[model samples]
Target chain A: MLARVFEASGLSSVQISLLREHTEKIRPPRALFCPFPFGLALGKPNDPEFQHRVLDHAFSLLERPSGPVLEDFPEEIVPADAPVTPAEERPPDPAFELTALRGYYDRFVAHHGRTAVGLTGVPSTRFRGLVRLLERYAAGEEIEAPTPDLSAAQYARFACDDIKAFFREARMEQYPAENGPQIDAWFWQQTAMGPMMRRVRDRMLASGDRQVEMLSYGIYREPDTPNPEWKYLTPTAVKTDGG
Target chain B: MPHLKHLPDMKRNEMLTFPAQVNHDTPWTPPARPLREARLALVTSAGLHRRGDPPFVSNHHEPDYSYRRLPADTPAAEILQSHASAGFDRSGIQRDLNTTYPVDRLRELLMRGAIGSLADSFYSFMGALRNVARLEQETAPAVAELLRQDGVEVVLLTPT
Candidate 1:
């Protein structure tokens, strides 16, 4: 859509797409459909060579003298591709995990000069309130929304994202060798937050708000369930290939 | 594999009928110039904005049709994402901005002469806009005009 507009307006455009189905529908002038999951348009975090390779393919499409070119990049990077070395020991609690990872997170900020923990619009120092909301929700209590405009489930979803990001970035700093999906798999499939978030989703559904039903989907997913797949979960398109 | 195929029996039919717009004529433009001489710009649907910028509404009932301008010089830390979709993975982006925006990698390309200069500013819109009639009609063209004003000859768009 936006890509089409840019091309229609005379700007040479190319996009990296996660869901080929939707791309096929919109038929943007040029698209490179990646097998990577949603939210990961490029191959990996901290992998510059791969990123450049993706870019190289994207840039090359510009010279084809073509219409609505949609092609697949040859490589596929999945979380299952990473080697899993167990951490020394799992932390007993999210708070404990947060405490343990702060030093590394601070170092990441000092060295990289940025952090991705601000989606909540709440300060890093005030993030614990959001965290506590999740904790109390998981403990089977009705919870209030962190921000005024959203429902508890909505804020819980974003809060968990922020908390997961905070912890993931710190863990990445400690173990620079770990890939993003590997860390994410560790957090969601193997950590306390995963089960806790699942509990939050259960409660949200139990509470019975039509809005929370959809928002709860992103809060958590189990190891091998048929949960929402972000790839074709585009705003309007629903995929039909059973991956 | 197409994602909708993997949905549970109950949700598959409803999801399958969601009505994504299909354009028989996808707009097209070939290379206007050599990559090394073109002024490139990044346009994304990642809901990215500078930290202090007004956050996009994460409301489920509505999509934010507005766009944000992120200067090429904005610090990596200052760029924040407020995409409202519940389905995408955030870990890759949370760890490396390149996975989504690739600002640093684009900079490297500029330095290495893989291509020419970058636009002074890049653009972003929130992801998963359920209704984009306004976007296709207004905001997007407005953005195109901005790119034209910047002399951006090439654009690389990454969607969340």
Candidate 2:
């Protein structure tokens, strides 16, 4: 994606990594990695109070920035060498399992129903992929290599390709498909992802890393090219003269 | 169901909701050395996205997710017009919030020597996401890689 966009537009770009494994793979202008938890990459939530402090620290790294800076979160929530949780230790609840899956499927329909039909042409197949992915994740199965790059274009293709398979997999008739009340409840149930993301975000918040991260760099830059030396990496404006 | 009444506070100051004040003399702690000096970048979860960009397609949704990068030289008017997600009181928000999510302000600081230097770049994205697992697994990593390559030192995040 970076290569495609950057090369095409002649725009400079950068990438940050929280994991060391990606350093060589991404090959951006520079990179930094923090030992903070997943969602709280920049800082924790609700602690806007503390997040500012962390950002203050992260900005300090910009001076003479080099290849990649992989630093630990300023604060420590877990030991340097903590043990990973095993699947057996975190046994799944069958009842919660059913509910979670149902909820996820329901949500899949609500958010994507419009796009699903347009892209997939058949909505059921999208549900099948959701069920399959959720079941696999719940069972603690390691996802195979090359997880599908569900970028905007690719997702549209996936939806279109798998529309039919969804009906076969979900077996919509088994449940009260008419009013879809149960499905609605399940959709709300899936809302738990927010709290879950927040939980992990809390961990990052606890770690105390403030530097902001971008999803795709330079994709938002203006068209006119500024002087090479006049680099505006942050949110700065450039004066433009009427052509 | 029942209705109850409580006495109001006697203190006049208690009613104020926001910080309402700032102590410029107080030692202002800066972000990390790199982040503190580097041009500022912002990422928000306000979902202030363009028309065509893939608008947070994950099954999870966060309407409040929004973000914007204020160029150091960016005009306050431009900031106001850039994206609707830059929601806040126009006056105090442009300045006071700069003390927090100061992307454009930071760059100006660096240019004017108010600060030493700036990281090569910075970033922003909408703040809200429902399916956090994908957020951590896919989004964070993608963002991390982007920041790393850009050599962004400091990133200001405004979560939805």
Candidate 3:
């Protein structure tokens, strides 16, 4: 919608859309349909080279001398097959234990207050339940068979998302209104929970835990060798398909 | 197969019912100059904001017709994504900011002279907005004004 506004205001604009059907229906000035999962419209996470290529393709649309052009990206990003160990087979990272996360949350709230921390809808009192679920999942424990209301996988996702939101909101409170880079630096480097999460992720990856692999989707890691099947969406292909 | 084919049952209905505004009359504005000389700015509906900026209130019952004005030079690490939509996967964006808002890639383009310079400020809004009336009447115009004031000749919009 904003793309139309920019175009109506006389600015050439293009949109990188995850949904080609929607893009086709809306028919923005120009659209690039990326065949990536949600939240990865630009490219794979942390893969700067792939990201650059995606951006180049998106910006190149500006040179197309027409309106309502929708093109699909031809590249296919195959999910890497990392080993997935059952929860019971892996040991949990003690550093990110429920108690530790709670402690970190307490300290963070104490320093920054509760201003931005409650957005996740997960109450402070329930942090223990959240942490326990995460710990169990990290350990590769079978969760669905035990929990009646929610599967272990569901609980893990909720817990991790809540934790991430808590840390982010708390970090926001500390700065109030600061520059982006400085706050980002503080979140990843200065905040205790941020580094702790990274450590837990690293540990999980090393153990080849399936839950971690599922949860870590889109977290970019440079492949040992670039996949050979990658292809850029080209005008010729779009023309042949009558797109 | 279309990625939307994989959407969960709940979201499938919402996608089908989503009242997307399709303006068939919107005029095409070509760049005034060559690609290497036109000024560029990024606009995204990915709910991105500077680290310290107030996040888009995803819990609101009504569409939050608000935006974040990120400086052109804001580092990717400094940006945060807070949209609470369930339609898309967010794991990649969580690890690397560029997956949705490619500010770094734009900077690289500027350095390599693939495009002209960037605007002083980029814009972001939550893509989950359901109130098209408010967005059309209030937010879009405001953002358009900002781009016009910034002298942005081209905009790259990435929607989540």
Candidate 4:
């Protein structure tokens, strides 16, 4: 493990281990095993109090005057979002969703003083139109990139990543209690963009474009995650909002 | 990590071969002092980098043993995570990078003198490495020396 390598170099280190099995196997000098979900090394996001508690635990392992110490983190983190459930409302169009989320996202930016959007160099204000153009390509229609510097495929990759980032950031603003997986399930299982992007990915693969397939797979879905199976959230999962 | 256990068959099959990497001797290094006085740095396996830095290689056959240095003061917007590991949930870090990196919490510690100070920058590596040998043989010492030179007395490691 990396902690062992660092320790070998005469640096004392303590790590927050997400996997107890791996920690037990590798046996780093000092590690605090957290039972939190994958990718949440510090438990819940947006909660500094919990994050500080996790950090304090990991750092305190440094005080043990011994070798190869591993401890379990004490607290059990209850997920912030409600149980993953079928959405009672139809998956909204990206245009309407983007427009509706803009104000809350702006508030998020104002409150946090930063955003994870802007990876594609396109301004946030124009995301709805840009998403419209990008989605057209996902549907197998050919379209040119907005700028000459990037190709349509390349721009699509960037656009895809940026739009998803925007959605997550904005969604967090509206649903601060939702955990990470809950938010991701909402995007991939309950959003129109999810299936549209899947079409873009499938088309790329169907065209024998290995490079693009690899690129889009990295951007849109984690190939190993339970996502992207394209099975859930069918018409039965939809309900009429208001006639 | 539930996701690791519940990986798609492709990944689950691959992860079962990690026992070979775990056979190394357990190395130990006692802390020189308490954490409150020790200068600290973060080392994350979250595949994060600044905007302009090249990403980790995007496939499983060949892993990129390279690392990226992210300035501690970099804004959340300037940071980017390019990990493409299967079944890994990125949405948490996407919402608040502190879930994995916790630089904000570290900054708070530096302000309160919960620790002496933070290194000017942090180190990052992509997770889901099939080749830990190269990382141990090469990149680890390279980064260790970098930390040594930077006067970092302790490290808090986080992974995605």
Candidate 5:
């Protein structure tokens, strides 16, 4: 679904995994790989061209008629050997970027207008973290931000714009808070949060590695909710359709 | 029939290693449809992204990869320009790849009566996802719902 996300969001993303003994099981006849470490699937530290090459290689593999192929970019010729640079090598933040965090707060206010800090209690630290990351990127520093986890209660009432503003403030050093109140409020209400929640739940369930039943009770014979005939299996079971 | 562009040495070498052996026992044959006459629908992963849609944009770190459909009349130049990598050899020459999967190109075909009508609509998604499980589950179902809703018949999946 990475494609789905990219199509939806206009942003590119990557996935990485470390395969040790299970490397054999990692066979996707249709997939291509880069010569980088398994966990570092994209490329070596801060190399966009090498990363693009890896991605291009992966895309080229799709036209291979049909088959399994091993892609090896051994150490000697690999781009990873290029000299590494420290994060500090990036230029200092722009002038306006200094107020990025404050602007994020203003956007949060404009989107969630007039609420007590605790009402839409998103941690201030996340807001700060987002600003810092945005400032770095705007200064032309290539880096990945830490994925912040916030309490649902804290963000429950925070409108979708508030969250997007948080990320916007993180990625662009400024939030487009001027885009009217209605648009900001409506975006959050329409966000497909259900999927994100499910992803988190799936991760939790897999880590527990056991089948856990969720039971329901009702007062008086409760009206039936349409449960399908099939019992749940892995997430793939729901996706099955004859091709 | 038609000829496609000649495969290069490097590409030919890669092609040779494909595990699926084709021989007389399981020779490739037409699936009982005339490809030229068929009312085709294409689905590609050729980086056709929309703006601000969370699901499509969530994976932005890798590249601006996604999918789109070209209509039958969509100029070949347009496809080549918009999605440079979706190009194929001259023989396979999808002069208008849009003609088949052209969700965008289908409007003219509908007007011209090239085929009965669109199955409903064509679809595009990024094909670079490494986790097939989630893709199969959540994303595929949504696309299926869209296709089913549009009343599509055959689906032509073209991954770039």
Candidate 6:
């Protein structure tokens, strides 16, 4: 939506979209469809080459000098066979232990209490349940189905997001007006939960369980690119002199 | 193009019934100069904000129609994704920040002379807006003004 506004204001705009159908429907000035999973629009993590390629394709649209152009990225996010460091090869961050997560949560509750953390619709009591699920998943054990109130997927979301909230709030309190990067670095690299989540991802990949895969990476299917049959607005083609 | 075959026929029908936003009257504005001589800015609906900035309100009952400004040189590590949309998978972004906000890649482009310069700041807003009218009338135009103030000639947007 903002894309169109930028263009309407006389700035050339291009969008990299995961939902090509929606992009085509909205008809941004220029759109590039990437078949990657939702959050990873550019490419795999730590892969600069792939990210640059996606950006390159997106930037090329700027030269088109037209309206409502939607193009497909001609690549798939093939799983990279990059070597995974063995668990022992990587030293653990003492700060990210389960106890530390609990500590942060406790500190967060003590500081801001339930009123601040309850927004996620996850009661504070469920923190332990979330941790247990993470432990089980990281250990490669079968995860028990969540109770009717909280499905397995919801449990995962609660765990990850709640932990993030705890860390964010705690950082704000500690730094008292510091930049966010310090807190972010601590959460992802220094926290025990970070490695734990990575382990969970590794385990899920190794298990090859379809449901688990979906929960971790999301449903991977082809994007619904615009076709001639769909009723879409195609602006009259106007040739402009190269400026 | 893949058809919406996976969706139930009724759901597909409902989706088709939903109105799509198309404005045929908006004239195309071509860049007046080459990219290497134009200032580029990034505007994303990926719900990205600088770490210390107040996070976008994701609660469905009360959505925030606000945007965040990320400085041109802000490290990808410092940018956080707080989007509440249930549609996209976030694992790739969680693992690598570049997937959503490619600040580093844009910098590389500037160094390589692929683009003339980067805007002083980029903009981000959550795309899961229930208040489309508010966005169109207020937030977008406000951001566009900021972009104009920064001399942004081209924008690259990554919509979540």
For model 5, how does the per-residue alpha-carbon lDDT over A148-232 read when each residue is reduced to its tens digit? 4432211221222233333333322243322212222222232232122223233323333222111110000111321111234
Q: What are the models' TM-scores?
A: 0.83, 0.28, 0.63, 0.78, 0.28, 0.60
Off by over 4 Å in 2: A1-16, A24-30, A76-243, B1-39, B43-160
Best-performing candidate as measured by DockQ:
1
Total clashing pairs for each candidate: 2, 74, 7, 3, 42, 4
Cα misplacement distance, residue B60 of candidate 3 (Å) = 6.4
Residue by residue across A1-243, what tens digits does model 3's lDDT show?
778777887888888887666666666788888876656777676688998877778777877877677888889543233233322421244233434445555665565332223323467667655555555655556555234644344344444555655554444444444323334344444444444445444444554544344334222122231111112223342221111
- Looking at model 1 chain B, report the run of 10 residues with the lowest lDDT sum: B1-10
Model with the higher lDDT, candidate 2 or 4: 4
Candidate order by DockQ, decreasing, is: 1, 4, 6, 3, 5, 2
Cα lDDT tens digits, model 2, A62-102, are 34334333333355222122123222322133234334355
Model 4's C-alpha root-mean-square deviation from the true structure amounts to 8.7
Candidate 6 error regions (>4 Å): A78-97, A100-160, A164-243, B1-26, B84-86
Q: List the residue pairs that clash in candidate 6.
A: A38-B89, A39-B89, A96-A191, A96-A192
The TM-score leader among the candidates is: 1
Cα lDDT for residue A78, candidate 3: 33
- Report the poorest 10 consecutive residues by lDDT, candidate 4 chain B: B14-23
Q: If ranked by TM-score, best first, what sequence of candidates would result? A: 1, 4, 3, 6, 2, 5
After TM-score superposition, what is the CA distance of residue A127 in candidate 5 from its true location, in Å? 22
Best by lDDT: 1
| Model 1: lDDT of residue A54 | 91
Per-model lDDT: 0.75, 0.31, 0.61, 0.73, 0.31, 0.61
Better structure of 3 and 4 per lDDT:
4
Q: Which parts of model 5 are misplaced by more than 4 Å?
A: A1-243, B1-41, B47-49, B55-101
| Candidate 1: stretches off by over 4 Å | A81-93, A138-152, A223-243, B1-19, B58-60, B84-86
B30-136, model 2: which lDDT tens digit per residue?
23443324443455443323322333332212222333333344333232211211111111121123322445444555665655555453334443222233443
